[model samples]
Target: MEEQRVRPGGPPAWWGHGPPWRDGADGEERRARWPWRSTVLLTAFVLAGSQIAARGQLDERAALDPFARVLLLIAAGQLLWRHRCPRAVAFGTAATVAVYLGAGYPYGPVLLTVAVACFNAIVAGHRRAAWAALGMLWAAHVLVAHRLYRWLPPSGDTAASWGQEAVTAAWVVAIVALAELARARREQWARERAERAQGARRRADEERLRIARELHDVLAHSLSVINVQAGVGLALLDTDPEQARTALTTIKGASKEALGEVRQVLDSLRTPGDAPRAPAPGLDRLPELVEAAADAGLAVRVEGTAPRLPPATDLAAFRIVQEALTNAVRHSGSRHARVRLTREAGALRLRIDDDGPAAGADAGGGGNGLAGMRERAAALGGTIEAGARPDGGFSVIAVLPLAPPHREEEDR
Candidate 1:
């Protein structure tokens, strides 16, 4: 079986999540029924309006005979399929209107059917077809009204005035121009909707990445400390009861702190618009990282100080340092690491190094740690470099902008 993808804040595609234009014809067709209400109303209007028009022009045109009424019905009925087959309905209505006029029937709402069909066709993106259909109808009316009137029409009729033809031409231009306007407006609205959807998807992706990074940094650093302490506790459990108790105490503190941070991260998801309960961890929390590293048996020496910073930049800097130290604890052979912070004019530089021979092949946790660190830095228009130090050690350096770019904040 194949799995289907679902969008956040929207149903699956198969659930018909959007408009027919955005989704497809199948979904719209499924929801469609006979256009009975509209079609019936239009037909009645054309029939009744034609009767009054024919009575008024009783001497100039044919009476509203049964045949003339049928022609009007056919023209109006063509609108029933305007949405399903716009081009066909457009041409069909125009053709019917032309025939009704060729037989000298009184002009009434019959032309309205053709206008409505042409409008739907143009709005449905069949511009050329609708234009041609209306043009053909106009040309047919011209031929019958001018040259074929004597042979085709009831009794005796004269050629239509050039002024009337000009009026008809202008009407045709107006209809086409109006449809073009509607089509352009619809297109602009669709573009805006699509951009809004795209932005929503982008923001969703960024948020998911942020949560994952936060969880990784918090759990990885905490778990590394807990793992080391757990081992120490078990090793000295019987031989040195006091030392074992102290190790257990460290583990308890690390686990409790980890739970608090994890809960904070989860709280943001529960109430997205609410302010965080605790201030986000920043360089101000450096002592916590140092204390945690010491518990993990990795001696960490910190150098330099960072000025107060924006929440986003501060958080990124804090996470990068935490992840770097976590990696040092888990991968480096030596027990010592050094961290240096250099504040430049508009940036903060972090450099972390540990003497190493590399604990194992999977020492860097297969690159997720490094990738997460790099992502944190890059999100702030910064860069990160980590590799083996030619002199038997590993080093990670990151340069982060003090102020994040405007677009980056919008993305968040």
Candidate 2:
């Protein structure tokens, strides 16, 4: 089977793990069903209220007609879609309540569902629709009051008292306010989650870049040595057996060193249940790096004592040196290179110069070696410059702060 390659800059697989409710459309669909379920529960309450009013167990003026009962049930049914189409359902339920009140029916628990519809509108971010529905209810009550006072016989009673209408308005406003408050809280929570996801993606990208730098440093130097020695061995096999044998031995040693470093890189990625990993390469390992570069036919002279460094700075500095040497060996025709290190004012300075023919010696041209070194330096709050010198050769210089960034506290 072909290996699955994760695209560069893609979010890591681990970041994709979380509660299913936060996965977007599917979770919204699941949550949308709750309003309907709530409507089902509210139906029982509406039915009981109607029964009590019909039997005169409660207010006799609030007894609902059979047609008004049908209308109430219809309004309750409209509540089922409140979450999916909050504005539409709010308007439908409020209109049904209005018609029920205007048709000379006694007011009962039917309009109670209208409060829920308004709440759903606010929860669904439709505050305007919720307000509009509340306004329509108030107007309906006004018309009902006017019809009773201006036209009804003085001997007869109104379908609903002004006190009842005022109470319903208060309930509608309260429910909408509570729903809007909840909506605000939900929005805040979503914003926080999005920010966290962005942070995780950034950290993942930085980690992948660090690992890429490590792999490039290890493989580039080791492979360059192996390639050069293999060519030498092939060239001298016919006449100079001892030189060819020495070249073959260098290739074997370089390959072994490359395998060990690459294995360490992979081990760093092992799951928690795996065996403990060996420590990463640091400044102390520069000898091995220098030897590998020398095996590739570059004569290298080291200067200055390596510093006792923080883990991040140590790893970054080592990679920078390794990448610089790899470039010197791989890209240059010269035989000698110079590496100088200095500790000054709480920072480490590295300068690498090679006495090579400066043809096509652009540092970052067509390769990530120089760019990786620059990234390592910048990540440590430092700077790197790689370019051709004024006289003739190429040079790589970097300054790395010993006081690592706050992220270094958390470790790899």
Candidate 3:
């Protein structure tokens, strides 16, 4: 009966966990704040303007009333909570203006304060409230103008009255336009920020997938070697003590190498703030890997000619050789394997052929090891082929391009 490897449970390392952007979306929004200092300064400025307007208009009308000053104070103070309660602030300020006009206090700078409140309402996304305030102020202006025209001799539809009404329209339109423009800019900035965050998260996911492939390759090969050597050791411990010792030693070496590579792969996930670590295992490590396979009692022959390869291609090549040797050692009943490598036409080609039972190969075919190898090669803009070699054994071949998959897009 052919050996059957026990598979690990759970989804692939690359899967699971909701989209990173979804977590970002669930984050709390920044709460609105009312700038106490700025509000105080604005209120002071409004008070000063009202005082000046009242001073000038008082001589032309009735003396200033004490209660009107208190109402003015209340309107100015409401600015402190403008962000927290924009509609309330706007309504409060507008009502203050109405009171001033009704109490016969000259409509001077208090009108400007109410307009500012309306602008704040619009800025807070309270468009309905702002529009209501605008209508109220306009109505107040019309009524006040009519009353003054009827009672005051010099104010009978005078140019001053018409001029004030015109200026009111201009100011109202200006406030609404400026507030709407500010809102648009705020929304645009938010969208840009969200897009940037999503892009960052996307890169993180791709990085995670890459690391998962590396881990799969490392563990799969190393465990396969260890498993085979352990079996050999256990079988021969009594019959051939020396050979058993050698098998145990081989298992140790293979496990140690696997652990080191695994550590290196994990270090890649370390934060940038960590001390720098070594570069990943590359093709230069292939000879050592082949030696490890030989130690595992497999006859591994190598014939390779290659120039300096890119980092990604080099890593893929090492992992491919490692995975092929691991499969050969674990499942191939035969003890002989061949590894051939060549750099041709701007690509690296690797081929591993083993005299292993096609049955063991068939049993391991659906494993993540093979899937990971294919994924790694494709990620580096390459391709892989693994199948039974017609006569009796299994073969794995990989062709890796020098350039990355996104090279053209990056260049552009």
Best by TM-score: 1
What alpha-carbon RMSD in Å does predicted model 2 have with respect to the real structure?
6.6
lDDT of 1 by residue, 1-412 (tens): 1111122224554232333222133535532765777889999999999988888998889888889988998999988888778889999999999999999999888888988899878877888899999999999999998999999878888999999999999989999999888666656545555567788998889899999999998999899989999999999999999999999999999999999999999999999989999999999999889988988888999999987789989999899889988988888887998999999879999998988878977544457789999998898899999888888788889999988877733312
Give the distance in Å from residue 291's predicted Cα in candidate 1 to where it truly belongs: 0.8
> Could you list the CA RMSD of all candidates, in the order they appear?
4.8, 6.6, 10.5
Looking at model 2, which ten-residue stretch has the lowest summed lDDT? 1-10
Off by over 4 Å in 2: 1-23, 27-36, 53-60, 102-109, 146-155, 158-166, 269-276, 359-366, 407-412
- What is the C-alpha local distance difference test score of each model? 0.84, 0.74, 0.71
In terms of lDDT, the best-performing candidate is: 1
lDDT by residue (tens digit), candidate 2, 1-412 = 1111111122442233322222244545555556555777888777677666556622334456587678878988887876567789899989998877665455567768888788767656678888898899878777776665345322355455778778877877787778777656555545555666677788788778767878888888788888999999999999999999999999998899789889887776775336536776788987877777777888889999778899889988888888778777777767889889999999999999987675354532336887788888888899998887776778888999989766533311
TM-score of 3: 0.78
TM-score each candidate. Answer: 0.90, 0.83, 0.78
Off by over 4 Å in 3: 1-39, 58-63, 98-109, 146-161, 269-276, 343-345, 360-366, 387-395, 405-412
- Model 3 C-alpha lDDT versus the unseen true structure: 0.71
